[model samples]
Target: MNTSKNRRLVILMYPRVREMDVASVNDIFATANTILPENRRYQIACLSTVDAPQLDGMYGMGLRTGPLYSTFRGEIDTLIVPGGMGNELTEPPEKLLKWMRKQGSSARRVGSICTGAWLLAQAGLLDGRRATTHWNQAHLLARDFPKVTVDPDPIWVKDGNIYTSAGATSGIDLSLALLEEDHGRAVALEVARQLVVFLCRPGNQAQFSVALKEQKTENTPLADLQIWMQEHLAEDLSVPSLAQKAAMSERNFQRVFTREIGTPPSQYVERIRIEAVRRKLERSTQSMEEIASACGYGSADVMGRSFSRQLSITPGEYRSRFRSSGIMAEV
Candidate 1:
């Protein structure tokens, strides 16, 4: 392997920055270094604005972060800003914001984890760019910065050289993506395997889980109806059947379901069935027709269409991309 070039990755740590966000991404690059030859490895460093020997993280843990001034003139291949409670401040420290603006301007790539998007936006780095942050804080980011396009659904997003991830664990996913972009799929996959994470979740994958989305309501009847819907995904889950299960008139059930679940009954059922089909596609070697039938889609074509409409990918394509390695041989 040619080892002529190395990347300098700097993670910016601030008081109360989320420890997991910084540590997880750091471990990924550090592990990648172990996987590649010495000359091809990444030089990772953590820097903080505080002129102290140790920076205190959100959870009161001490992190070894060099003074922020040390990084202002360095060649930063990638500059990472981590999110934390500190992001909630209306007026962030002026010095830190200035450094971020300067470093972000010159860095080859600039990225953030979770609410770090706030810092990037504050620095005017995300204006006119598409970005995502922790789902809970996404609205705030958009509200605070109207010029930036906020996408709340994706696990991570990359618009040009700027990348932003959803939440804590999503930072690891973003790091894997960066590794894949810097090296190759083989190295990224190997690193993911070592980390025991699902291999390379596409940036567009939903940050929310299907199970959690389905069970969002507290109403006993609605909760039971959701469970029933999941169990009988192959059965007709139309408004009438679900309303009957809930013992409410169809009109009333539709109103309440939409209010509590945030989706129409029909749409929710379709999403559930689609989620079921996706799991089978990722884990099983069964033919598409069989898996589709088992997941209540009735036919492979129907499943494929649903996958395309909802996920923007075909069932076969999803399987190829996300299927476990153990099932790849059979595929």
Candidate 2:
């Protein structure tokens, strides 16, 4: 019975839960725990709405929970809720909202994912502050609670003591952000690397994955072509050039690519280029001009404008704001 709780992170799990929501939170905490100084580790627990449940995940897998309240409530540090079927977003359970309101009053910090934002909003905790949720539910949140400003962009949002994230595993991104806020960028970055997470994705980053939208089907000819395109980012990419690479007529390639990916090939290439640029911004000290050239853009202006268009910030600004604290530095 050696319950060594170096850090406390409690998540409220619900039925029909997107497995990724739970897995993402668990993965980040697990990775962060491993990196903790031997004596300093995290303790994560799952609690159900009714205190516990004999249940299954969103995709129908078995699961469990613990007590209704934390044993270390006086020392409890962070409280989180995972998104699934029910929510405090539109119509909230008076009891659930009351309990959540109580937790928000007592805990050092409060957080939620996707529809979980709905719960917080219903609890009267999110009024007059900016927050976000899954895109499918973002509009609903705004419509229900006119007082809360809903930004349907960033993968996550922080409003003073309240935190909410986009759909599903964006919870990981939110957790990583909190890790950085609690420990430091270095620890969070390490956690992300260990989990093979792309980066400590900032709250200002896009909610949806452009690369995911454009990814080709597995084992298909187009899939192989897309992989090849990703590999050769620096090469001249034109309709004729890429069509030749795909072994198709330029006109046919353009039509087929648009149909499959929902965007023109050139736009997809730009999305990949921006992803590369964003990664460089986080991990390197390269100047905007250097990043643009390395990522296949012509100049700093191109990179800066592109970032502003997609991310609402200049490349230099994004790097300064998001990368100021060196990776592995103070959280």
Candidate 3:
């Protein structure tokens, strides 16, 4: 991978970084290189934040890294920052931040994976740009950096040349998007097929939220009711109906459901219904009316409105963007 012929891509590494965030992004571009011509390939270099030949990743994995400053000269085509446990601590060294600030201008594009958005924020690169990070840390990023517009829904965001993505494999999604931008949709899709990953996930697709899955619930009735709600989406899920099914008064049911589930019953119902609708849109050949009926939406218009309100995308648009290509061709 010669810098003179290939596109130069630098990955900024730090101790305790999330290994997945780094490895997945690197793998996407590396896989692309195998398919692309020599002159069009990506020349990837991993540069360490600390002056160390090796760094221990967040999960105790050993990784070899090059010295940050000793690497190269001239403009970088792409500079990526990966998130990890390191970001939970205090701000990174001013020198590192300064270097990033400088490179942010020189690099054709700058991106952060997961919590790496924090490093970019600390350097003031994302101050006025719309960005996203892992859903878990998105609030902290927003609260800490009031100047940056933090959108927690999307799996990734591209506001100008600065890109940010959600947790874990979203880095791969971001890399694929960059690959498509550099080459074409066909090349990126082939790379994704070779890698055994999804061809491409649109940036605006909602992050896989663990809204109901991760919530704590100790009451047997509430737990049973939650499962029942999912299996019976088309049924009346209003507070009165659910309360009767739970053998409790409406007031008590609402209070207990909210306390146990970490969200009001109505809101939780909407979220799960939307999740169901999203799955159908992506995988099934069903029409909007069919999906709406199956997902318990009263009508296609109701489902579209729900999608718009919750995901900021209409059902038709979501299907077009996320429907599996093979499945899409059959339609």
Candidate 4:
């Protein structure tokens, strides 16, 4: 509102943007301003390719721009990129990549929400750095960009100047983290509260579907089987027993299981077990030994050690940090 102030954030919308991606970024910036006074918050604007009234987003959606579109000139401090499935159309255009590269030159930082990392890589911004995209697209990104290290495990990846996130609404997590980085943990928490969303999610925490996807099965009997498998997690769940529980021979069970879920019953059980352990650690007062027993671990020490190996953090610590502070994960 004043000539002396810097309204420094520029969000780059793809020709066909993911609606939620743009919405999340704009929401965070808007909420940050409301939380901090206008004097303290960053200036936010929609910077599309042109001075236009509306832009086409993915799924034939339309997004109207603010009063004016900002240029990539040095005035902008940060550049945010959001992804869409269409980016796989081919390598990014030379002019587009060049413009992104040019924009990055003076911006304080550059980041992507989900597969927007594709655009960043096309601009040569992600070379020789670690990044992530939507988990489903991670492999394609890895195969195409041999120089960029891909870590499918993180909700968001930050390597020096570049940041990439997992699919869709995970952009909110990335945006909240940016607020935390810019202001403080308190400001970030408050911003999340206003948005009615999670303050932050540990990057390595698997998306809920990460485990479920591998366990997909076409067996019409799988609903009953999966319910049975979940019910028996605390027990010594073996393939033969699960097959028996499903009323099928082990050979039939395995075939039906693979066809339906894409993974063997034994491995799928372990994933479900891990997810249970995390929950028990978070929302319950169960001791390590108790949780271990409940999740079919023979000993508390073994369970704790397994948790460390899998999560790189002790189960107790994870609980202390992330156990339901009232923030809801958007994913």
Q: lDDT per residue, candidate 2, 189-297, as tens digits?
A: 7887787775556777677666765675553777887877777767777788989988899999999888887789888888888877877787677787787888777
Task: Work out the TM-score per prediction.
Answer: 0.78, 0.81, 0.76, 0.76
Q: What TM-score does prediction 3 earn?
A: 0.76
**Over all chains combined, what TM-score does candidate 1 have?**
0.78
Model 2, which residues run further than 4 Å from truth?
Answer: 1-7, 34-39, 51-53, 70-75, 88-92, 216-223, 299-313, 324-331
Per-residue C-alpha lDDT of model 1 across residues 79-145, encoded as one tens digit per residue? 9888888585657778777877877778888999999898899988999999999999899888999
The ten-residue window of minimal lDDT in model 1 covers 322-331
Q: In what order do the candidates fall by TM-score, top score first? A: 2, 1, 3, 4
Which portions of model 1 miss their true places by more than 4 Å? Answer: 1-4, 70-73, 217-266, 276-291, 305-331
Candidate 1 residue pairs in backbone clash = none
Better of 2 and 4 by TM-score: 2
List the candidates ranked by lDDT, beginning with the highest. Answer: 3, 1, 2, 4
Please, what are the lDDT tens digits per residue for candidate 3 over residues 166-187?
9998898889878877887678
Model 4 steric clash pairs: 7-43, 215-261, 216-260, 216-261, 217-260, 217-261, 218-260
C-alpha displacement of 49 in model 1, angstroms?
A: 1.0
Q: Give the TM-score of candidate 2.
A: 0.81
Tell me the lDDT of candidate 4.
0.75
Residue 297 Cα positional deviation in candidate 3, in Å, after optimal superposition: 3.4
- Candidate 4, residues 108-210, lDDT tens digits: the string is 6899987788889888898999999888889989998899999887778778767788888788878877776677667777877787773356454555443
- Identify the candidate with maximal TM-score: 2
